[model samples]
Target: MNPAREAMINGWKSPRKGDRGRERERDITAPRHDSSSRISKPARQQPPAKSTASNAVGKYLTQDQQSEQFVADEDKFVLKQAKKKADIRVREQRAKPIDYLAFSLRFIDTDRDVFDDHEGDVEVDIPAPETVLESLNHAQLQELHEDLTSYQTLESNARNKEFWSALLVLCADRRQKLKPQGPEGRALASVASDVDNILSPKSLEQLEALEKQIRTKLQSNEPIDTDYWEELLKSLLMYKAKAKLRKVCEAIKAAKVELLRLVDPEKAEELEESDGLPANSHNFAPSPAKPATRPVASSSDAQSSAAPPPGTARFSSTGNEDFSQATKALYDREVARGVGEGEEIFAAEEAVPSATKPLWADKYRPRKPRYFNRVQMGYEWNKYNQTHYDHDNPPPKVVQGYRFNIFYPDLIDKTKAPTFKIIREHGRRRGESFAPAGKEDTCLIRFVAGPPYEDIAFRIVDREWDYSAKKERGFKSSFDKGILQLHFQFKKIYYRK
Candidate 1:
């Protein structure tokens, strides 16, 4: 045995007992001491350093830049620690509601100017705002670049007046939102810059003139001429048919298309162009306060039409029947039976109904669309002020924000039946999150928007033993409580005038 070697290991003040005791003490005391205090107290964390952030599409760091950075080692470490120690007291400045409204108007005016394909022949091509150009490989980028250049050529060509007009309209739209100081509002500076270079003074003046005219036309009363009357009638009929048809189709589609948005089902909506513009969302604030002046209408005018009022729909007289059995029965008994003097009862019934029209299609036309959204600017409004809002409307609910604003696709006419889509909200929650209750359950919001948003707050419902189907989503209010302040894209909404 190597007695000297063993004796040396044992004798040379190993300090093993004290070291083990200290380690044990730390392991026992760690829970009692705030872990953050241990490191940060000694290092003396500095305040988090502020830096400029670009909203441009991609990250902008060369690999070598990290090495080139000339920051003091201790300062950098201190700043990093400080960021964790101190709560960031950032002053959030929200975009004006006008920014959103103007952007929306620009979207509408741009579409009308560029892509309102009455004949469906016009080639209006542009990538969506979210299109990640840098993410593409070189070949894809080259192809995209070529497509964009073609549009640029179209922008300059006087013959392609519509294309040019669209660009000018878009330019003006963005230009309105242009902040004289600070960052440009929702309007991209790059887009505004391009428009400036492309459009000359004469063209700019023409565009301004055209916008004035358009605005004037929008405000003017639409002539209720024969063509307008006939089309209005036609639209009413078609809308009612579609509305009645939608319920049945919706059930069928939901049963099948829960996992898919069908490309081409005759019953499914035709692939329409992007709703006026690319669906790019931005942070929004409430609309600017404006004094509203509404025109007073006679009670007679309001109730004169049998059709459902604008911004509303009247379901078929039959309640929840899968088919038009009552309508079919009436048709067969009254209108279907052609009349003469001997058939007095039937003839009299037919006369009262005015149901003797030759075609069966004419019999059950929509009860004269009373509520059509006539112009892009309509009389009807779905207001959300302190007065009208019912916070817990559509009960069994969870919306615990201080206040909320609603947004919609602008330029919807109340004379036509508008569709509903998903509506979003942004505000602080009572709790930290609404986790389990989101993306799975549907919240039937009673009073929401103008052309309302639906198929939102949506999640797959369970059919088994547990019948309860509600969702909790995103940052839950219960957990993420006061810290979770929500923000949404604002609107340029005014009270109905």
Candidate 2:
């Protein structure tokens, strides 16, 4: 270290600058020949072999298997996400509506306890008549009808009666408008409304007496508007049907209450004591000794206590052969067939009076069968409409077709099917239009079925039906499985340039 520092001092004092510069250049240009001075580089690692096994397996999978695999994978992912969210919610102490309901129900002693406090009180707030009538659109009115019918079956009380009557009055007013009648018809309608209100509270026997009187009037050769009398008879029958249904529902409710009472320990003990069983009977009772016979007695008691099947009891309560399985089936079918989305009800009538009674009227009472019909509406892109409207701004929808579904489950003659006839007013023939400008001609399409089911009719636009067998045209007229379905579309008129 001392010699190197002396040499570096001598070099710094030397005046030969050219020789020192040439030596530094030579040192930088020279290569390192020593083994230790050479640095080693790491070997290039080959990339891991690309996996073709997954691709090969995927290539062999069928369409259905692939779909199933995709669904399973999606389900797994959804389950994972749901579980994670549930854990987070649990940690946050968030409760769902059902959880709250379950917690509240834990304190309740019995089912009856939930409603005992609010007995004889209306649970829901009913809107005013005007408000309801104005607010309810076509679909809402249909829903209201369904709800009221259900309420009538479950709870046929004074409150429900008031609601039903109000609906009836509304319906009557609508009917009068649809079927414009003379002065005599108007007078009869007012009388009918008053009679309906009076008959609302009448017992089954009283209603039966009134029905007989009306029928007698119809059967007699008296000067009377037959249509009004027949309508009255039909209404009477409907009231009778409702009364019978109510009685059955009340009986069922009572049975359920009795069963609940028996289930209660205290009530059971009270009942046993009331039935002349001694308090200390258990100590001396021979019932335990003959356990084999107890099952037989219990079985018999169960059979006796069981309520009759509804289908069998349906028409039996009326004590008449008039209301058959067909009637009940039709009623149920109509109830189940609610208004379709985007479809409008053009005209719906429960019963249309028949001019003449069938020959088998005595054997089976002639009554108008129930029907639920619909009118399909859609934009008709004719020359006028196409010129004025586009997809973004559509034209007004007109009645494109009619769908008539009538039920007659228990037709007397199964071999013979129902038929329909078009009845024109003012002696107007087919293709003849006596209607005012901008109005279309209309006619009654009366559907005639076998005995016990009277003729029902509906007014429809007088136009040629599209009888094409194509699905788009939707022309169908057939009676199958107790339903008479007549679906047809109007023939579209095209204007050529």
Candidate 3:
């Protein structure tokens, strides 16, 4: 080999000055893991300490005798991979929840509260109850509510043992951490009671750990002792107590004297009274005691009370009257019930009652007049004297218009009613001065309306009277404030071109 060639090769392979400095620094600081560091600096070795769980927990050993107290490269690699798998879960979470601080580029979140995924649409901003018995820090109160809500929503099923156990732990934590004798405690206790419904003796399958324990004991050949029997008895008693406690807590949580009272005072009392009774009682708390009947005016009303007609069931024989919602709802329910009872009795009887002495409802039945009756439709229109007219013509004056249109909205299969607006000038006005033609009419007398009221009955009597009615009256009142001087009963509508 040539000396020059050998020198060139060595120059390329030799460490650079900067690399040599780094190598020297590493050598000086790097830890030593030789056999001397692991055992003692002796050739002979005694038998190693027996391997045990967690390095023989509770056994103290001097530092001089302890094995190399440092992690191995193989163990470090294993731990790194295990932690990577654990962090993958936190990184994939949509809510970004964390047991400890973490960060991830792929972390996803949502528009709603994290817990909303469990309980659909939680109602936020609910005003706190006024009867709080203990003062709690903001964090404590927040956590208290969250745990209560979680426990309340957790379903106890065979497949949800983990959820039930987690909920039980949360409940126990809240019960212990919160003021045990205060309002917050009572509120939490009520929420916790809901668990009894899910985890009572009837749903024992939800407690997998306890069930597994029992199974293991039953499978064991070892003799059972009195302590085991006592344990089982205690569990049975607890189940019974919880079963009864659930109903009481549910009632208190729903009653006006407790939960509902904070939300609504008017209905609180009514609901609280109902709470004491069984939930299945449909007729619980009889409809609040009925009030005394008013004096009846005529026999038209079929009311059985001492009060006459119009006392409750119907209006006086002649004039118009309306029943209030409360009054009508109660009266209708009672009447319907009574009618049903009468039918049952009649069906069971051997003979029918004569027409002269029919059931009370049939004997004094009230009649609801139709909106448009077929009578007095041919009343003679005397526009000359609006005030002087026969009683047969309900209105003394009416507005006449040929161009008016009536509209009906929401009709099936069409966007518009079977009607159209038409306008024609019968007489021209000079500079807004009216020039009455042979026939006088108005365009303002028309009205457009939505469904259920398109066919409003109207009569053409006098346009002047109709205009005056609009200015002087309300549609709901009486006082002869009629828009027309004459009214026609609904018989047949006419079409003219």
Candidate 4:
């Protein structure tokens, strides 16, 4: 036989046909190595299952005991899998406890570890009183005027009464530290509730009567006869004080749909009409148009009287407690010259000499300031001024003085005619300054010099930072703490050697 045939007869497998031939040849050439007397090892058996349930998704069937009739169809398989999963989930869910009363109870007895304890002294984040005062100044009023002009066109674009109502309600609310208790404590809640009740089907007649009565009383400036409701009606009327009663009218009309649903339809209609006064009523009429005709005045027929001429400026030394008359006269002159209402006149007025220094500048002057000598950049220094210790003759204690020593690119001229310029504090260990030259934006630094650096400490008075603009003053010092006992100022120098 061939070597390959002989290898096959020996009951040994070959890797390939060529390898088989080589293996057969080697087997034939070499001694016979094996006899077929070895027994095969048996396969290992799996552990017995605890239950008959198979934890897999399919028709349950045994390896040899499968009956085609017992096999589950696709739908049955899916249904069985879903039930098994659902049962497992239910068992897991039941393992955990559910606190049924937790959600229903208003208060809990659990440990109060979530909230922080109240400290004896707590700081509030309200705006400073000084900032509030600034907001009420002329600067804020000017800003409001600009805003009014910019947003006036969109005023009538939407009929969103809710926005106005919500704002009014918020303004009426005053509590700052805690949430409102309920409808009684919350003004918004009360208003919303009242609105809801008024829109109900049964209250329509009462709403109509209320509106009619309110309208009549408003026209006559008489109070409504209703007990407490009269005050509520009055408040509503006052809310429309700046409007043509149109806002009130519109609110009442909107309430009609709800009122009719709650009350009688006839009553709802009456309230609607009352909310909006009739066309003939004075409460609803649009303002009359101004006349277009211009008045003519004769040139020579109007001979000049003893009255002051136009553009004539007047200065008075008599300190009147009330300058109303003088102010009105000035305003009239401007108006006659075509200056619109309350508009500022930039034109220079006729020059009139003052008899005395202005009271506004000296009315609240400090006694006397202490003086100091220091040239600094961004450091804070504090010392006492001589004014605080002087019981007898008081010399004007001024701020620290520095001589103009070096001429930098941004030096400001202090003599004769001076121009505003940038300043940098050179000697301070900490701090930086960059000033630009401009009429409106330049800073006016006051410099003073009197004593040695050890004599007094310089302080800042009425200095403020504009956090919104991320800008701060360059020089910030204190006079021996908060007391302004010393005067300190900055000065330029021609040379620093």
Candidate 5:
């Protein structure tokens, strides 16, 4: 312990003169170990020093330069916003165009009177269900059945229910006709005759109850005829569809009446009074007042008549009155086609009278049919025109073709097709012209159909028609799906060089 204490005290004391001199000499003479000689280590790069001159210049910048910089930033921002807004507007306003050809039946008003002269007219005799059914072959009957089923599924209106009942009656009549002497066939016919009663005057609750009862009978294995009861069940479904449709239509009508009353009380009252008329009446005018008491038919007479009740509304037996979503889509597509390039509306009007009164005018309402037509236009490009005008500066366009579309969805007889005829004015025959210089001869094209639709006509340029069946000639004349179309182009005339 004494030795260690003495050594520590000696180390703390100042170094001897000889030891200090030797150490200083060794530090001075030893090989210098600069930073490069030491072990290398990574170091972060120092940032460049900011120039005080630039900062001083910024502080002294003029007001106009700052304003210009701000304006440039604002312009960039505004342009970006405007582009965003334009893109949104384009998306919102985009819509498909309409094509006149290939139009939908839904847009056509089957009962619309072009002349508005059918007021107070007696209703035409509705086709007998048996007569219509008897004419249909098995395939046609099946097709009709399928169409009705699809229509009923789409909308359950009173008119649809009536058609459905007529179909069932037709089926029952066929079964009875096949085995008239059989008791089962007679029983089936009698049961099927009650289909109308099952459909009409029954609420949805009542129909549902009847359905439950029929199911219960079947489920319990009751001694009831399975086929007859099953048929009743089918009638019940039809009734349900009808009831639902009527309920919806009534609600819509009531709402419309209320709205009309709020807007115009007199029109609402008139509409209400018109609604009270016999549903079969085609006229919108108020009916003649009736006496308080009327003769009641005998039960036997009433039972024998197959006519519908006075309150029953009449509708087209062939197709639906309202447009479905699919039909609307089809209508939109057809309308989008629009007029072809270099074409325009030429003539659109009903046909002029030819001194012959229609036979069905006295029996049914007489109203003009409706039509849409177009005429193709193009430069004649004759020798004189070619010499005077270029492609950029063309001559006046001349009529080159005609397109006619006549709608007749409500023809009284479905068996008959519409017809058209050309009428020359001023007692002039075909190829005869009395027009002044520079004026072209024109003729009326009259379209004829069965009542309640009347004849419609249009004036057209008189020219030689190209009846070639080639598609390029664009000659089409046919009546299909309730539309009578007559499209044809005129033969071009070329001048000799």
Candidate 6:
């Protein structure tokens, strides 16, 4: 055996029983040719070596000796020139701005038959330098991952001669060079304990054959098979997808924890956990163990937990509660616990901003006002006390001069449960005047119609206290500016003319 082969043999015994048989088969099939046969014969000549003392004497060789040395040097020079030319060609090929067709074929076609199809108007736009470098780095990482995975699988199935032989040869030829870098390299270091168990002469032989074939193809300018490359690309994509899913689940768990923290700071403090999403599974260390579930609260406990202290603002069970107030209170509770601004909380690094340019007013960019007021009303003029004699305190019916200019018609219909509040406060008047406590009915409209569609449907509740009990009020109407007005009050409505 050669020195390299002997060293490999000394490292470990064969991992497969069929190693000898495969070796014999490979040797029998290997190509053999006469070594003495030459395609082109050149005239044999000997050249004199220049003596060290000849430098002091200036020149020592005669014309005949010089010609012989030139002939010998010419052969060496041609060989060196050919090698230099090959090197230059490789560099030029690599420097040629990315060949889109070739790149597409690298992923799409294994035999690379599509390389010839690159002559069309298919020009690959040169990406920004950073983008190109990033992609190249990713490709290198992917290549390392694939090689390591293959090596690992082969090592595991060492009992199978086909795998053992292939792996052994790969390990022998590639050894230090095949070792991965980055995250994959770290993983490889961890799992490379059974290298001795997987190496054998047969495996080495198989790897050698494959390596030779690849080198031959590259030298001959032949393309690799499409099916092989397609399967490889698919495997890479699947790995990436699985890693992405894992990351997404980890992020969701982290977001849930943050939300829980915002809801109850004391509970968040009790938990005392880290507050960030997991690192990407593709390149990071394995994930930590799942967090434990929080203790569940009993119904009574939850009720006690939600109840406010005595003397604070309280909603009576009998009184009609405002839905908007309830919604706002719930939202505020969430925000206080840990909820961040929506866009900042969810935005990811990889997302690219949209390129579509907007109008000058909106450029760079300007935002429209989100709040506005339509009408003003006096607080005291809007309030009236409910009489004990009346069964229900009816709302005032408005006499609108227009029908089409309604507000929130779709959301404020008869089906809606509207709540009205009467604010009571005492205000100081000018000198010599005493301010009396006054109340105003400000109806809270929960459902509002969006812009461009103008219509407001309102509920005229007869019994504010008995809101759950429905009463059908008769129609009342009034005519003004060619529009008829309808009013309903305390189970009675009038049609005005």
Best by lDDT: 2
What are the per-residue Cα lDDT tens digits for candidate 6 across 1-497?
54335436665333245565554444432443546667667877877767778864665777888898787676544433332322221221211112211132122222222322322112212122112222333333344345434433423222222322332333332333444568745654463444323322224344445445545554574567654434333333333333332333344334344544656665444433633222221111111121010001011111111222232222111011112332323422322332212111110111112322334423222211111011211111232323322335444433211111111211223344222222221442222223244422322222122221122223211122211233333333333321223323221223343
lDDT of 5 by residue, 140-241 (tens): 455445644533343323543443454554544444454436776566668666788656778988888888888999999568878877877866776675
For all candidates, the clash counts are 47, 0, 8, 39, 12, 29
For model 3, residues 1-497, the per-residue Cα lDDT tens digits are 43334436755233456766554454432443445445546677787777776475547655643543333344434433322332322221111111111111001211112321211111111111111102233343454456334423432222222322333343333345553468744654564555445446463334545556656776677788645444453343345333333433343335324433555565556655653422321111111121111111122233323332232122111222122233233322322322111111110111111212223334333222111111121333445333566576554332222211121212222443232122223453322324366443423122222222222222232332222334322122111211112221222223443
Task: Write the residue-wise lDDT of candidate 1 on 1-497 in tens digits.
Answer: 23334336655322255565454444331334344554544667797755556422236765565554534344444432322111110001111221222222222232233322222111112222212221233443344344334343433223233332333333332333332645533334445444444333333345455445545555568653443334333323333333322332333234323222343343222214223222332221121221010001111112211332232232111111111232223322322222222111100000111123323224322221111010011121236333454554422322221111112222123333222223222442222333484332222122211221211112111111112222422221110110112211112235764
The TM-score-based order of candidates, best leading, equals 2, 5, 6, 3, 4, 1
| Cα shift from native, residue 350, model 2 (Å) | 9.3
Point out where model 4 deviates above 4 Å.
Answer: 1-154, 157-209, 212-236, 239-418, 426-497
TM for every model, in the order presented, reads: 0.15, 0.37, 0.16, 0.15, 0.35, 0.17
Q: lDDT per residue, candidate 4, 241-322, as tens digits?
A: 2132234335434543443545466655564556342223111111112111000111111222222223222211111111
- Report the Cα lDDT for residue 384, model 4: 34
Residue 319 shift from truth in candidate 6, angstroms: 29
Error of 3 at 443 (Å): 36
TM-score winner between 2 and 4, please give it: 2
Which candidate should be chosen as best, given TM-score against the real structure?
A: 2
Winner by lDDT between candidate 5 and candidate 4: 5
Return the TM-score for candidate 3, rounded to 2 decimals: 0.16
Superposition TM-score, candidate 5 onto the true structure: 0.35
The lDDT for every candidate, in the order shown, is: 0.27, 0.54, 0.31, 0.29, 0.52, 0.29
Full ranking by lDDT: 2, 5, 3, 6, 4, 1
**Looking at candidate 1, what is the lDDT of residue 44?**
70
